[model samples]
Target: MKIEVITLNAADTLQAQEFGADRVELVSAMNEGGLTPSYGTLKNVLQSVTIPVQVMVRPHSFGFVYDEKDWNTIKEDISIIQELGGNRIVFGAVTKDGEIDEQLLEKVIHHAPNIDISFHRAFDQVKSQTNAYKVLTKYKDNVKRILTSGGKDRADQAMDELRSLVQLSHELDGPSILVGSGVSPDNLATLHEHIGASEYHIGSGVRVNKDFNQLLDKSKINQARDILK
Candidate 1:
């Protein structure tokens, strides 16, 4: 299994590396779930970490439904990311009625043809998980993974749905399901056993004080890494 740690700054990025993280998802405004890191922050983080860093390209904290201006900002961010040697991007968009925004998604993919893309937790808001999976599968070549909690607040709480998604992922040769949200050292073993997902994402679960504002806890990250291993 690959351990993808979410880092808010250069310090957290270094901590992720020291603690044996396989990948780092870089973002700012983590309190708002995660907004795009500033260009300077992105540059410093890219220079600081050797591990693959997937930059979050979210324009706002609210919802995934974006307008023309929002899409333009996302494109600009992608350009900056690519220029700075960041080859992986995490983003997602959905229609008002709760479906994958295919038109916008394709445009983003077109903006960065060479980089790997992971649709973020916006997948959790879709009205039908299976239907959403089908829509995402159509762009499997471009979207390598989807970070989701199975349309629920936490992965463990949606084990059955996750299992079904994992099964479908294999069947369709679709995007791999990277489970996140509330994954922790306590339930890591159980989630691994039940979901059998190959990739996992952790944020507050790896913090020292269990607080998003605090820096990542190396002990907590190492503990989770050990469990996953």
Candidate 2:
């Protein structure tokens, strides 16, 4: 098991790596659940961090129902990220009626099926996680992981759901679940012992007092990393 921390800038990325993160998910406006960072930010972060950086390809936070313009921007961003030497990325989408947007999912992932990619937390908003999981399995090779909170507001509160998802992940060569949302060093041990997931995505959990505005807590990050190991 390894820790993947959410970072907003090159400084944050450096801190994450120094504090024991194996990988970093680079984004902007984390309060809006992370938007695509500027090209300059991406370039600087790539040059600053030696660890694997997973660039987020989201254009905006206007829900998962995107227009054609949004789709174009998303595609362009993915290509640019790859061109800029970013090998890993995170992205996700959903229909207005609360189902997996198969059209968009396939459209984006089909082009770069071999790249390391993660389907982000939009999975929580889908009507049926079981059905959603089935949809994601179609691109199992491209969609390497699903970052989710077990269809709940918080992952720790939905252990049963996460456990079932993890079990399903082990079958059918589906993408494994990367548990997130309120996962902290204080409770990661319990989550791991119960859910048995191999990866955990931490954001505010590493921040002081679990506040995003505060600096990431070095002690908390190191503790979480040791526990995951």
Candidate 3:
């Protein structure tokens, strides 16, 4: 099993690495969900740590329904990150009716062939997760994984649904199901056991400072990492 911590910004990079997290989902502003971090932040993470860093490609905190300009920004950011040697990227796009915007997502994938792409929790925003999961499975050859809370507010609260979705992901031969949102040391082990998940995502729960991105309290992440083990 792998323990992944969500690094809301650069500050958490060093501590996350020290805490022995398998990977870090680099992003910005968890207060309004999460937005894309700046180029400098990404570069710093790339330089500061040896662990894998998956940069978030979201342009803003608004829903995953992006506009034309937002698509352009995502494409451009993908190019920049790839050029800078980012290991992976996380992002998502949805239609007005709340379906995965395959067209837009495909374009980004086309540009980022060498990088892993995790469809962020925006997967929960879709009108129908079952239908959306079907569509995502079709792109399994392209998408690397799905970060979801099973259409609920938090992973623990949504464990049953997450278990079903995990089963569905396996049935469809899609990418991994990375449970996220409100996950913490307290309930992660139980959730992982309940869902039989190998990967987990955490955010505010591990933060030890006022700034969301500042260095994680190694004790907090380590405490959870030990529990997961």
Work out how many backbone clashes candidate 3 has: 2
Best by TM-score: 1
- Model 3 misplaced regions, further than 4 Å: 9-11, 209-214
List clashing residue pairs in candidate 1: none
Every candidate's lDDT: 0.91, 0.89, 0.82
> What are the TM-scores, per candidate, against the unseen true structure?
0.97, 0.95, 0.93
Off by over 4 Å in 1: none
Ranking by lDDT: 1, 2, 3
- Model 1 Cα lDDT, one tens digit per residue, 183-213: 9887989998999999999888888777878
Quality of model 3 by C-alpha lDDT: 0.82
> Model 2: residues >4 Å from true position, as ranges?
none
Model 3 per-residue lDDT tens digits across residues 1-229: 7778888555577778877889888887778777788888877778788888888888887778888898889888888887787758888889998999998888876777666888888899999998999898877876778999999988888899899888988888888899888888778778888998768888877777524645577777887778777
The per-prediction tally of clashing pairs is: 0, 0, 2
Candidate 2 per-residue C-alpha lDDT over 90-188 given as tens digits, one digit per residue, 9 for 90 to 100: 988999999989898878877666678789989999999999999899888788899999999999999999999999999877998999999999999
